[model samples]
Target: TGVSKGAMLSHKNVVSNVLQASGAYSPTLDDGAEFVVTALPLYHIFALTVNCLLFLHKGSKNLLITNPRDIPAFVGELRKYPFTVLTG
Candidate 1:
């Protein structure tokens, strides 16, 4: 949402804390879409809020990459999947 840590945290809590049951109803991940992640850690509030929570809620596969310095590799990874959304 916002650049400041406070704004980030605020949005994270409000956006990520979704209610979903854990059972066979567990949704599928990455049905078919464009989701690219470059150096975004799941632990971070930004990624956790937009990437982890939203994807899981929508049942999308999360291609977690800790290191995104290598642009070529990142592009390659991006090319491999059909993601609907690419987050930072």
Candidate 2:
């Protein structure tokens, strides 16, 4: 409901869910891959946790987006690499 660490905490929860979920719809993180988060790193939790921690565990690169709100800019940033995963 606010802009702070709570957002990061929530993102952490999402990462945990993805990692722990046994559902068939879930996709587990690969041992090695690159993840690019298009969501604002400072605006929400997904980038904070998943891009930071989970990728770290898998020895993946986390492309942190400082400003994800700008659509064109985001696309431009995305075109720079072949990202294995993009977390919103």
Candidate 3:
């Protein structure tokens, strides 16, 4: 058995964070033409908000790495795409 604790965030919190990120990053339509490669797991808040949500908001493509430990495969996958941004 295990113990667990949970926290909840309202829609406004999410939207506010997204908006703040957009303002900070200043992503434009040109970003939509690029791709974002993320080694961090999307289950984590930072990756979820910045790598996935932020790019999605900018209309950019997201290439998620299911297993970043596989060095060869990871490099191969990155080479396969003209990735513009890499986040770990």
Candidate 4:
């Protein structure tokens, strides 16, 4: 894959992407058992797709952090979850 600015995506594209991406990772994924620490704000595309939708489709437990600036709170949140996957 090459790098470029993000493209605009439709809801269907997103759903398809999540399904395909998760399928690519299925061999390593433990359906409904992964705990994900999603530090990124869901407003962003990468987080919205890979962090939120992808994991959600996998039935993962997500810890959404609206603010990642507060170091103390972020660390505290991290401590609370036995996260197997993280976005940062």
Candidate 5:
């Protein structure tokens, strides 16, 4: 069976993770200019830390994909933003 893993993560931990990741990429990434495509749900830890908080902290706008399964619509949306970063 296939099912999403759901759990609660502490704010401190999530923030720490985001900060750590941001630090490493900050040197090469430009602020307020990056467009990030987040295909994974924000509730997921990976998306929450890297796609949302980390990128947002770096002043990047994230295109949250509510329904990633719709490839046609997702691809169409991509044309609207000049995405420099993508994560799923």
Candidate 6:
């Protein structure tokens, strides 16, 4: 996976990607009303920008999964919440 060196992104770059993704996905989220299940580690750009930042920007709840490898526990946790969006 060591394919390239780390690249820096400005605040505008991050926000712009989030906005573009939101438009493309058209997530039907309500402020503080929807739940988002995020199985990927937040350290990753995809999870950091989309699942955590973008959803929070729209005021949706974020359910962080510390260990997605535990399938049973993951499924159990998923069932516990009426998640509106799921990203891994």
Name the best candidate (by lDDT).
Answer: 4
Specify the poorest-scoring 10-residue window by lDDT in model 6.
Answer: 24-33
Worst 10 residues of 1 by lDDT: 20-29
Model 3 Cα lDDT, one tens digit per residue, 42-85: 87888988898888988899898899999999999988999888
In candidate 4, what are the lDDT values of residues 1-88, reduced to their tens digit?
7876777788899999898889899999899999998888797888988889999899999998877899899999988879999877
Worst 10 residues of 2 by lDDT: 17-26
**How much RMSD separates candidate 4 from the native structure?**
3.9
State the lDDT of candidate 1 residue by residue for 4-42, as single tens digits: 553445654555354332222235334334354535877
TM-scores, each model vs. reference: 0.56, 0.59, 0.84, 0.84, 0.84, 0.83
Q: How do the residues 3-81 of candidate 6 rate in per-residue lDDT, one tens digit apiece? A: 7879999999999998887786665656677789999999899999989888887788889999999999999999898
lDDT of each: 0.59, 0.61, 0.85, 0.88, 0.87, 0.86
Q: Candidate 4 at residue 49, lDDT? A: 88
Ten residues in a row with the worst lDDT in model 5? 1-10
TM-score of 1: 0.56
Candidate 6, superposed: residue stretches over 4 Å from native: none
Candidate 4 has its poorest 10 consecutive residues by lDDT at: 1-10
- Candidate 5: count the clashes: 0
The TM-score between candidate 6 and the true structure equals 0.83
Candidate 5 accuracy as lDDT:
0.87
Q: Candidate 3's error at 85, in angstroms? A: 0.5
Q: Lowest-lDDT window of 10 residues in candidate 3?
A: 25-34
**Clash-forming residue pairs, model 3:** none
